[model samples]
Target: MRGIVLFFCSLSLVACQDPAPPPVEGTVKYTNAQWWLDGDFAAGERCAQDGLLVACPAEPSLTIDLEGGFVIPGLAEAHNHNIDNNFGFTRMNPEYLKRGIYYVKNPNSVASDYQYVEEDIARPQTIDAIFSMGGVTIAGGHPEKLYVEFLSQMPAYMGRDFDSLNSDAFHLIATEADIAPTLDLLQEQGAQFVKTYLLFSEEFERRRDDEAFYGAKGLSPALHLALTQAAQARGLRVSAHVETAADFAAAVASGVDEINHLPGYFVRDVATTEEAEAKYLIPEDMANLAAEKNIAVVTTTIISTNFYQDNPEQLEMVKAMQVRNITALKEAGVFLAIGSDNYMSTAAAEAQHLVDIGALEAHEVLDFWIRSARRVIFPARKIDCLQPGCEASFVAVSEDPRLALPLPETITYRLKQGYELN
Candidate 1:
C-alpha cells in the first residue's frame, strides 16, 4: 500500500510540473546598416528572434551584412482596391512586396473577393499582412457607378451577369431603415472598418438644372448621419470617398473618420477644364473644419492618372493645383496619409509630388509613407516605429532616403518578421 501511494504521488508531481517550451526560432542579426528608428538613425547592430527585435543576441543563428545600407520600416498602402479587380492581387502582390510595401489595405471589396484572396489564394510569403474593409456603400453611389462602368467596359473580364456578385458584395443602404442591417451585414462579413461614398447619381447628372435632384441620389444627409453614428457605436472607423466641395462638407459634417481623394477630381467641369482651381473646388473653410475635426486626408493624387494621360497641359495644371491645395491643407494642420490608388508603381512619384509642391520635405515624405501611413491603417497595432518591441519589418535601400530627393530605385534588401524577402 505504501509503494502504491508513492507511485500515485509521483504521477501527481509530474502532472504539476510545467511542460517544456518549444525551441525559439533561429535568431537573425542584422549588422553594418544605418538603422532608422524613431525619426533618426540608431545603433547598427540589432538582433531579432521569432519575428520580433530583441536585445543583442549572444550567438545569432544567422547574420546579415547590410553593407551600410539605410533601413526603414516597410511601406504601407493606405487605400487600395487590389481585390475588387480579381487580377490586381496576382499582379500587384509580388510587385508590392518587391518594392518593400508589406502592408496593404483594401478599403472596398466583395465578399467573394475576401474569401478568395484570404482563403483560396496563397499570398506571397513576403507580405506581412493585408487588411480589408468588406464592401460597404450607399445604393447607387460613387463606387457602384464606378464598378458598373468598369464592368461595362470589360465585359469579358467581369462577367456580364455580375449583378448578383455586386449585390452580394456591396452593402447598399437605400434608406434610414437599411443602415443598421447594412452595418450588421458588413460586420458579419468580417469588415475591419466601414466605407461609404458620396457622389451624384446618373439622374442628377442628366438633370443638372433640377435643384431637387441635387444630393437626393445618394444617402440623404439624415441617413449619412445615422450611418456614421451606427458605425461608430459598433467601434468601427468610417472612411468616406469625396471629391466635390459639397460632398466633402457633408462627409465632414457627418463625422467620418477619413476622407479619401483630394478635392477637385469630380466637381462640376473640374476634370474637363484646365482653369479649374483648387480653391474653388475645395473651400478654405471646409479644409479648416476637417483639420479641426482631426479627419485624415489620404493623398490619392495618382487617381488623376487617366486625366493626365489624355491631356498633358491639363496634367500640369492639375498638378499645380494639387501642390497648392496640399500646401494649404498642410498649413491648416490636416493629417495626410499616402495611397497610390491603383498606381502602386508610382508610390515614390506620389511622395515626390508632395516634396515638389513643398507640402513636406524629403524626410517628412518618408515618414508620411512609412510612419503616418501605418498609423492610419494599423492604429491599434502599435508597430509603426522600428523600435525593439516592434515587428522586425524594414527595407534596406541603396541610397539614404533622407538625403535623396525621391525614393532610391534599388532596394538592396527587404525584411519582414526578421526574415529576408529579397
Candidate 2:
C-alpha cells in the first residue's frame, strides 16, 4: 500500500509539470551594414546568442541583409524623468525609441507611479533597458515642489503630508538620520544611483539680491558630504541637480559623482535684465577643480531653449555664455555627458550645440552618449559599444552619425540583446 501511494504521488508530480514553451525563432546577423567598432566602422560577420555575441559560427542561424546602413552603438539618455504621462507622452513612447535612445535613466519620479507605468504600460519594442534612481531630493526640496501633480495622484498618500508617508518615490531626507536608511530603502527598491537636488528656495529666490541667502535653502555642504559618503559606501553613484555656480562648487566639493544642468541658470540672473550681463560668467576655477577630481557634468542645455524664444538679445547672450562655459569645462578636461531633461529629441541638438560652440568634435559628442555617458550610468557593465563581449544591442541608420551634418534623422532599425525590435 505504501509503494502504491508513492507511485501515485510521483504520477501527480509528473502531471503538475508544465509543457516547455516553443523555441525562439530568428537568425541573428546583419550584412552589408557598416558595423561601428572602436570609434570606426569595420567589415566583419557578427553573430549573437541569448542577447550576447559569441564567436560567429561558420554557418549562421540568422542573417539580415541590410544593404548598406550605419550600425552604431545604442544611445543612452542619462538624465530623464520617467513620468507616467508627460504632456500626453508615456515613458516608453516609440518616438523616443525610434530616435535610437534605447536606454533611459529616470532620476526622479513618484515610485508608485513609475512602478505602475513600468509594469502596466506596454513598453515600446525598441527599449532595451530603463534604470530609475527613484524619487530624489531633501524633504520639501526641488522635486518635491516640481512633482506635486504626480504626488497628488497617488491614492495611498494623497491628502496626507509628504513627511507622514514612507514613500518609495520621494526619499525625503530632512536630517543626517534619514540618509543611510533612505539610501538602503532606495537600493532595495532597485535604484541604480542616488539623485540629490540643490535648487534655491522660493523665499531665497525672492531675496536673490541679498548676498546672505545664497546657500540658505539648498543642501548644506556637510549634508552633501555625508550623503555622498553613505551612497559610495553602498556602491551607488551620486548625481546632483545644481543650477548656480555656488551650488556647483558645493556639489563638487562634497564629492558628488556627477553634476546636472549647465552652470548658467544660477551663475547669473539670466532673467534680470539689469544684472544678467554682469553675472554672465563661468567659474573656470571650479571647472578645473571638477576635472582634477574627475567629477562629470551633465549639460541639460536649458539655455539652448532660449534660442527659439522671442528674446533675441537674451539668446545671443546665453549662447555666448554657454559657449564660453562649455569651452572652459572642456579645456579643464571635464567629462561632459548629454542629458535632455524633458526634451526627448534634443540629444542631437545638444551635441550639435557643443560642436557649434567648438567645445567638442562630432565624434566626441557621439562618445558622450556612446561611451562616456554609459560609463556614468552602467559602471559595472560595458554595454554602450558594438564590440564583441558587449551586449548585442545597437541602432542602424542610413547615414553615419559621425559624418552626418546634423546627426541622422532617425534610426532605421534597432536591436536589443540580439533580438530585433519591431
Per-model TM values vs. the true structure: 0.82, 0.78
The runs of at least 3 residues in candidate 2 whose Cα sits more than 4 Å from the true structure, single-residue gaps closed, are: 1-27, 83-91, 120-139, 149-169, 200-216, 265-281, 302-308, 343-346, 352-359, 405-410
Q: Can you write out model 2's per-residue Cα lDDT over 96-116, one digit (the tens) per residue? A: 455666666666644554554
Give the worst 10-residue stretch by lDDT in candidate 1. 1-10
TM-score of 1: 0.82
Candidate 2: residue 359 lDDT (0-100):
61
Residues 1-422, model 1: lDDT tens digits: 00111111221111111222332478878899888876777656877787777787688887889888888887876777643443445555666676777776667766665665664232225343444344555545545554454533442235633375454545666667888887777777778788776654223345333444433245555667788889989998888776555667778898889877776543355454444663235667888998999888888775565555767776666666677667777778787887756533435566666676565788877877886545677776545666678777778887878766324366898776655666
